[model samples]
Target chain A: MTETAPRPTLEAVAARAGVSRATVSRVVNGGDGVRGPLVERVRRAVEELGYVPNQAARSLVTKRHDAVAVVVAEPETRVFADPFFALQLRGISKELTAHDSQLVLLLTEGRADHARVGRYLAGGHVDGALVFSLHLDDPLPELVQRAGVPTVFGGRPGWGEGTRSAVYVDSDNRGGARDAVRHLVGLGRRRIAHITGALDQTSAVDRLDGFRDVMVDAAPGLIAEGDFTPAGGERAMGELLERCPDLDAVFAANDLTASGALRVLRAQGRRVPEDVAVIGFDDMLPVAEQTDPPLTTVRQDIEEMGRLMARLLLRGLRGRGGEPGVGGTPSSVVLPTTLVRRASA
Target chain B: MTETAPRPTLEAVAARAGVSRATVSRVVNGGDGVRGPLVERVRRAVEELGYVPNQAARSLVTKRHDAVAVVVAEPETRVFADPFFALQLRGISKELTAHDSQLVLLLTEGRADHARVGRYLAGGHVDGALVFSLHLDDPLPELVQRAGVPTVFGGRPGWGEGTRSAVYVDSDNRGGARDAVRHLVGLGRRRIAHITGALDQTSAVDRLDGFRDVMVDAAPGLIAEGDFTPAGGERAMGELLERCPDLDAVFAANDLTASGALRVLRAQGRRVPEDVAVIGFDDMLPVAEQTDPPLTTVRQDIEEMGRLMARLLLRGLRGRGGEPGVGGTPSSVVLPTTLVRRASA
Candidate 1:
């Protein structure tokens, strides 16, 4: 049992602040109608008393939990090994902390976990949700929509139904890939090969689209499939070499794959920059800088995307979307990515 | 607002299963006394009806929110840069998911946030808490203890008051450090230098103690303090070399620090292993395997430690704590660490 001390109530805070209980309650629940002086007094009294705003009490008034669930649907170990999700989470944490809202993390590994998460979200346990890494066949996006919780996706949802009206924060994967390929083209490299991430994800598919945007009518042998792993990158690079032995430039889906490509190129006695220029996406520092020759890759503001997801969700929750219960269509965000110059490219 | 579809209640589940409401409740809440056949029937009914347990009703019955708050109280950006917290979070999430519980992540940056966290824990919002990376001067431990919430520390709590009876899960840092030093000694390196992590953290302090156990009368100049970052490691390695030019081996506190030391050694024209046999701790794969000569380091089961902490906390919450309200004294767990020998050492 928790220590048996009774917590200070709104009445206590009101008494200390010389204000009405109603005023204290209003201030605690975002101070909608409370005046500035009264709000300041109530806040000071609450702070002095070390009082925590009771979610139960607050829910009784607003019917809101002031909590958001971040659902990450990743069945593959490859995503977990990279720092992409972690960096995004840091941004989300910082933003949510500033908002004084709690973060509930829900990680779904497979079909069963997805169903479980769908049920939890449907149970009205949280005010909103931030769902991430949805594959082409994932049912989570639709499930969340059916649950009717205001949600902001981390990336563009790949599934067809219900996502056309959905809000999401995504980096310009297509444009970033275009920039990378353009940089390689500007370097006087004629035969450029492309190594793609797992095609199931929209991020990878979008990058491939961007690659095709620049490399119009390129030889089919110049493309190889990689699952965004170092080993996968090495294998893909080897296959690309076998098919196009004279290829002078390579663009990988992510830094991990590019690092693997770098190792294979080094082992095959191909000097970076001199013999072959390499560029990757998602400039993950550990992988990019640790490469024999530091990698030049596309940089996405991952943490900022996380922050934006929370900011948008919270704004919707604040009734800024429209009427109190009928949250209007929340705006979606697409952040731009820049090419980070390094020795490899 | 959430979809208006009425959630199936306990009465509905009971009616569907042809059993009493109490029996359905027991099955839903872990099937404590319900028989196998009846439990099966209730589960099927639950599945058929899509019955999601109402947290409000459950709290009224069992006085538990079925939520665990994970408090990470590191003010430094270095901790966020690495993937350490993410791996631990994955382990905790998996365990919590298996147990049908939710995770509320509380990230505290400084003193003000600490107070906010303390009040939240005191407000009885969660059933328990798992706090990590506690500094010696941290007030969170005391606040948690006073709240009377069952907590499982990720590392040993550093405070003196109210923590003697606290439960925790930790890796054997001392033993791991001793093994690293012994391996170097076996390699016929007499003059070895040590780079210590921040002394405020118990992990670093325990590691330093282990180094002292192995090098009883070593020169004071051989030990340099690092803040568990790459830059700190570089500075420490530089200082160690300037002070003791004859040192043949170096044991860094963690892999990030060791990576920095490796760069410094390379820049100073010192051939690794031949001139300076370097070992690191944590064996964080991204840093360890990606280093110039892959690092040989101490391997602590960080994810396992996270899993164990959740397991212990859940076991305590299941009324194994003697009285229903008065949780019994939970035992602490200290997991062993092994040395992963690679080319560096």
Candidate 2:
């Protein structure tokens, strides 16, 4: 009931501190003009009054919200379902908290919402923006850039050749995929089919390219593409089976796709590892464990990726220059992906 | 680069509109008293000059942030891994967008961070707070209440005898559990075993109580506790098997627990449905399908729960006074939970 009472104001605090409103404002703003003893006196006055500086007023002067918006260019369902997003979000939250900043999560799925989001960011609602799961030609990048707001991407944008510059943190997709396929080839499988992810994403393309690089040398005839979704994997698997009936093994772009491939293989009465060995990427723990005979897959530290993304955003917020282009200082940090060998492969 | 230029101030808009500063403020605030032609003239001037009201300056008067903080007490890994949280979050996000508000996601796992969160909410960082996955005797509710901030719990708090009231949206755990057990009993399962969620949660207690209520008449000696983690389910299953070796069926608290139970049952050489039937709750789609022999479980619309929570918070924000006990009228919305039969039971 008492909470419904009017909130305390800065003027009230200034009155209590026995100082001019301008002096109190200077102390509250952390401006250097306020002396040490006077600052301590103002602080004591603040504590006694339990006064919180109006964030809006502070933001007006500073032009900083002390908040970062993470814009996901996907549906809310996909953003929530993907472990990658969750992990990155955790990192961002943690880093922002350390700096006394708030994390604002925005999902730009529908076209109307997309425009609304663009306006919100442009209207100075947050200090900077971090974007994730971008497609080849998302207008968000250019739009935010034109607004003069510092923007970073979670992964490299799919389009634009020659040194596209946006600070990004990505996993070692290319090397990891190459290593996964090389392992399959080492097992002496000649026909290694691959289920790709959404072609519009750089992650999917890099992963597919890695698989192809190894296959072109090891086995020329075993290449296939599938969307990252499980159903996509299943459909692509069925197609691959029809096209290459004798294919001895398959590499999936992600765990969801791999799970689908495994189901299709089981449905077709193919013995796992013996008749058709299977390997999936992004060894999401639960999915990896649930698959029949488990799943042999590539493991990327999703939490670390999230943490790095947050760090990059934080560095940008602090105006720490010299980020490695679109990929960050390293251009792209390729976190090591290890193979977790299980029954399927 | 034009965006980096200082935004046009309210004073500029006032001058351009040939009006007093208060008139310009009233127009920007959408306050009553401004006439139609003047309002239209002021609006056109605002559009012409691309004048966006400074949120910080406005907040000093309004004391509202137009932001809501969503606090997840669980760790980042759990938040990301659980489909339930993600689905609920999506619902909340969608609703918040419609209300033209921002959402701040806070994960309060660490002790230091928890205190920081308490202070942040108390300091008027967010308009209101929505807490999820609260454990029994958690001091957060009391802390936030003492801070004079309106707070809502995702589920009912576990401690006390319902003396503390907070607006909550929850599934009918009792009815869902009863339905699951009753279905198994209808199928002539004499030795039914219940795998419950963590005892610290109200949902877990309600679910176990429901199972006990149905089994009290049919088969009384069938109950086991699980922490809602897959590993916890496995341990609980092992214990149940040791105590009730002839158990013919199971009703797990959640899909993860059910999956674990299924794994353990398979390892113990039990055939699903044919030999030992199983039913899990919280019908997470992918996990339900991935379970060996699949799983029959209780399905609650997680997204709807999220939407309702957001709506409740928005209502509180709008001063509509429909919220139960805390600010306005308290309503306990119990959504229906349905049973989906599959290969498991």
Candidate 3:
């Protein structure tokens, strides 16, 4: 039964408190110029009237919008459906709120949208930018850096071509992939096929390299590629089955892809574990639990990746610059990936 | 082979275009006095110099932040893991970009963070606000409305107690649930147990009501409640199994819960669709395909909901201070849902 209410402004608070507008501003901003008695009065007025300072006004003086943009280079549909991205976004949002900053999300998958995004980011739209899921030779890193804004990448740049070093946080993809493939070999699978993510990304390339390093001595000639999408996994599985029919097991780059491969295998009348063991990366709960026979996969701490990225960007915003030299702890982190065993592989 | 680059500025663009800063501003803003030829010249200069305007200077003139805040009233962990919220965000981000606005995300699940979010939103930090997952009696709607900012809700308010008449875009929860249950009944499923979402949400209440309304005349003593989470579904399912050992079907409030219920049924040696038919709401792609024996569910167009919400909010923002009846239709929109039948049900 609340009535229509007028919003309380700073001027209203100042008038109610019997003080000047400057005095109210000083109190609201916690400046040292305000007297104790006046500050107490202003606080009382703010509480009573529910006066909230306009963010636009504050940004005019501080030049800080108290907002950060999170740009992900993925398809719009994938961005929404991918739990990894969602978890990271949640983590970033939580951390930004603690610092009184807001997180702006931007998806730049379409080539046509790139120009528009560049303009938005360059136009003083946000205080900083956090770019995730970078591919080799992406122009975004260079574009953001040249604009003179503080920017952070969510994962390490695979190409290693940018002049301005990027501050990034990433999982130990190489080690995780190695561990997964080694586990398959240990399970006595003589012929193991690998379903890889998009090769343009370091995540895909690194995982493939790790698998190859393990297969060099144990099993070989069972590698295929996918675009980290379910459909792509299904297509890749079809090709793999056609080429390597005797493959005893498969390792997919992600859980979505693994689910797709499982569907394809089942359609083709293959029994899980007994005939063809399957493993996936990114132990997303829904995908892992619902996959036929469940999926034994690799797990990445996606939430931690988000937290570390936020912390890194905040440090850069505070003028800490990039971490020291090359191989000087890499200015990037590689979190460990654990193997989660289930009925499938 | 890139070199250390300097940040672009209005001065740089002016110098490159052989124009004054005032002329450059006019071109950048598409101000009235600018001629077409000169505007093109200035644009080319901006492109060449990669000039990004200083946000502080822009704020001084426009008094707009060019940003909107998307607040999720859920924990950071769940916000990302939940596909419903994630897809909504994705749709919102796309629409905001089309309107040339930045999207700022906020998570206010923890009680300790609520006050901070209220202050931030109230502080004029964002031009508009989009809130999702409102529980009954939540203070955010009132707080935002009292701030005089345009606010939009993702779902309909159940209790309807707030001062602000929120413009919301909701899925047809009632109809979708009815359709799901009707399908099960069409398959001759009596004693159909109903697993609901959180009862506090209108969606959960409406969906449960839909099931009961259809079942009361057709069948009785076949209702159970779940919290719409997978674990909640599993637990509720276990309880329901004990209560009605002869139940023939179940209608879960969401895909996650249905997936969980499927797992429990499998563990209990129930043959899906043969011994017990099961249906779920929110036809999430992974859950539909990956659940053992697959799942039949209701599909709510998540992306469309997001797009519609963005369009509505944009209309509201444009029609500010005018009559609320300007947007061709009432601010509230309820989109229809479809039944997607698969193997399980």
Candidate 4:
């Protein structure tokens, strides 16, 4: 192995610059009470010796770590594969990097890992947190809120109520669902069945409610539950077909589920758009664009949502209070969704 | 906003425990000079006050951060969607968490972010680094090596040479590709085509080399470049068909690319397996299993590869020298891959 030289010490730099150790420390920590000549000499010595101050020492002086925790309360491997997770992280990563703040990720294995995250937050390891607690049953929001860290949620946390201090950034899931259903209705499809996502998640419940909002007092047989996977979509589609063979259109909760439904429709000899118009949420390009006939779906800015979460957290950290729509108590931002028309619907 | 009580100070904990400030500090920093009863009293006071030792002060005494940086030099959004990245992260995250360390993710946007990453590493912000520098021209490996933190690479690295100190964890790309081609050969396939991933990456380059090993002196027209994307597969497959209309089989660089090839095959009226056999690398289940005819491909334990990298880095940090296959100098582990047969082949 190639031997690596030990990190250059402050003493080494001081000796090279012909200055005292205190002077070198003063120059490195913003050059307070130091002359310009001494500072320049110290800086040149630092550059020449590749000297970098220990983060621990610098952090002690500043009383802050320029880092934020992105805690994800997801144990399932499925979520990791979802482009939704990846894109959101990218957005957050980009935003944090631009602010010169590091992203310290904390992935929890559901309830079992919640305490660890709680301790980490209370430990002052990071300045703030952006938490993703997707399920209504997830107790993470409460734990995180109790930790007393300035936090912004990724989605409308599943507690199903307005909390004055809970700040969150979410897309208009219910509104998007309404748009998908309305589009199906505009295409003259009345008996439109719905394939919902995992009911545990607020997004799915809201989407189902959106379907109900448009199809008020609709037939009970018109909806089937899905777990937001292709296999789940396939099973729900088969069940829907058995229950209502004459249904004219279908709106799936997300693109992956819609693709699965497409397969079942194709297998059952139903031509998409001709026999059954299909629309999905989250116009996740890879799946939405690659489906058999392509899929007409709702497009939410997933990456933008991530960026907004970081922005909101950073703003809060800067102590900018009472900013409308964000950076204050009761802060919330709901991004709008758009309908992307394709051959499927 | 609900008010958060201030963090309890070390002095407060000492006063609560009815002990000297020095005794409380000693107990908190592992109780070397304190008796068992005094340590127990300090512990109770800490638990009651919910006191967490300041990381900066602790690090000042211990000279360790108990954190590892996972540096990925990928600017594009594509890799995030690739399960390879997510699964690997999950693996590394799990290992680090179990060891009571944190994972600091550094997502680089190519060259512009390289200097920042180097500075972060050299700043002694983390105990070590696990770097993923996929491209050949990536200057990251050199920068990281110069930073001199104990490090491990994700893939075999693109430099294509044996370095005595370069430690990495990579799947057996060449061997996996060999097995894929052998399966085609067993099925009496001739005029086999190869759709290569981005040649800048070592994994893609190795897979391409593997194909050449099986079909020595094969026609140059049989090979086409792909960027390890579904769209790339579609484009490369079309070119291959145009150049050699009678091509009987294809080995795509990865599953996403193979799915694209499958779509093109369906569009071109070529019956899969019957008319044109297809196989892909990296059996990314969501893509591989969802393809029209499903996909026959090589399966690499991506998550396990991630775990191995973390394990090796941790072992090296422990200063456990000369453990074979890992932890010593030239620590590298090439995990084997297997062919998963499905409907496509």
**Which one is best on DockQ?**
3
lDDT of 1 by residue, B150-231 (tens): 7888988766675776788999999999999999999999999999998989999999989989999889999999978899
Error of 1 at B110 (Å): 4.8
Worst 10 residues of 3 chain A by lDDT: A321-330
What lDDT tens digits, residue by residue, belong to model 3 across residues B251-303? Answer: 99999999999999999999999999999988887767899888899999887
Chain B TM (all candidates): 0.83, 0.86, 0.84, 0.90
TM-score of chain A of each: 0.82, 0.88, 0.84, 0.88
How far off is residue A58 in model 2, in Å?
3.1
Candidate 4: docking tier: acceptable
- lDDT score for residue B113 of model 4: 70
User: Between the candidate structures 3 and 4, which one is better when assessed by DockQ?
Assistant: 3
Instruction: Write one digit per residue (lDDT tens) for candidate 2, span A1-345.
Output: 112324556788788888878888888877878878888888988888766665555666766666677888777767776666776777777777777766667654344466556655665557787777877766666555544566667777656431166667777888899989889889998888888898888999999889878877644345667778889999999988998899999989999999999898999999999999899888887889899979999998876776677676666655534435433232345577899999988
Preferred candidate (lDDT higher): 2 or 3: 3
- Compose the digit string of candidate 2's lDDT tens values, residues B16-92: 98988898899887789999988987998888876766554565666666677788767666877678788788888
Q: Give the whole-model CA lDDT for all candidates, comma-separated.
A: 0.82, 0.76, 0.78, 0.82
Better of 1 and 4 by DockQ: 4
Q: Report how far residue A145 has shifted in candidate 4, in Å.
A: 4.7
Q: Candidate 3 chain B: minimum summed lDDT over ten consecutive residues — where?
A: B321-330
